[model samples]
Target: MVPDTGKTLCADTIRPVNLPEPVAVREDAAGRPLMVALGRRLPVAAIEDCWRVDDEWWRARALSRMYYDVILGSGRRVTVFKDLIDGKWYHQSY
Candidate 1:
């Protein structure tokens, strides 16, 4: 769970909210996100958690997602992931 920040999210629950517009991201040496473009470029304040999932390998389009739970410079928390299969980034919450 995330700390309370006055957002609508319940302190003990996470929900998926797909990005209306996917943003471009700049990664650090270890391939962790350092900045994200959401309306404007916002630096990542910290990464709270991370994990990976690889599925549907036998399908024509497989799923290889690496998700990162991060806090922005403005103190807003978001979950973003890289689609390893397509090499793109998207913001989501779980």
Candidate 2:
């Protein structure tokens, strides 16, 4: 389950969370992702959160949104979600 810091920490007995297939980040005029934007630009705001849920695990890709939070950057604060199926990442909002 997701801890207080929003990190997924499955204990010994629990199965791993499923995630989505990885995706690439294209610069389409929008600001870069936090990972890429970290060194190059100083985020106007910066925050972190975590999640850990197990749903639809029987399906090829079955997971649920445990929780999310707003992280502000130099450009804007976005809500990020972790797809438990394939370990992919997504933005909740602009």
Candidate 3:
């Protein structure tokens, strides 16, 4: 036996968490991030890692990005990425 609460589960009711947000990044001549604007500008201390992702190329809207894991001057680590298709920057957490 089961009780009906008049509720349903569907994709429409689902939402993404920790989706990347647009960010302001200042890059050097070599196209490396020097500073990033969170609330204010924060200098990048070091680039710990870098990688690229190019997926779903057969789709109408493909995904392509260059990701960087860096340490800020305040010793906080953050992940940022450049959208290769749109030339935009974003900050994300993994």
Candidate 4:
């Protein structure tokens, strides 16, 4: 469970939120995903961490994702994930 530190938190229940959003991304020459656009193009001030999850690969609808914890230019921190199976982006919050 995500700690509630005066910020939005994801509940323990596993719900379906399969919505995908289009975000403008800034990348290094090596093509690493850097800045992600929340509303406007914001530089990635810092990437707190990152991780990958691969699940249900045997099923027809599989789950594969790469999640990043980042602080935006405006200092708003958010957790964003890239859908590796479909190459899309999404933000998670309460």
Backbone clashes, each candidate: 0, 13, 0, 0
Best by lDDT: 3
lDDT of 2 at 91: 49
lDDT of 1 at 63: 84
Higher-ranked by lDDT: 3 or 4: 3
lDDT tens digits, residue span 26-81, model 1:
99998899998888889999999999999999999888999999999989898889
Worst 10 residues of 4 by lDDT: 13-22
Give the Cα-based TM-score of candidate 3 against the true structure.
0.84
In order, candidate lDDTs are: 0.86, 0.46, 0.94, 0.77
Q: Please, what are the lDDT tens digits per residue for candidate 3 over residues 4-94?
A: 9799979999999899999999999977899999888999999999999999999999999999999999889999999999999999976
Instruction: Indicate the worst ten consecutive residues by lDDT in candidate 1.
Output: 14-23
Ranking by lDDT: 3, 1, 4, 2
C-alpha lDDT of residue 67 in model 1? 91
lDDT of 2 by residue, 1-94 (tens): 6459766656865764543323332222433334423234433244455455677768876766533443444555545555544545554433
Q: After superposition, how far is residue 33 of candidate 3 from its true place, in Å?
A: 0.6
Candidate number with greatest TM-score: 3
RMSD (Å) of each candidate, 1 decimal? 8.9, 13.7, 4.1, 7.9
| Candidate 3, pairs of clashing residues | none
For candidate 1, report its TM-score.
0.74
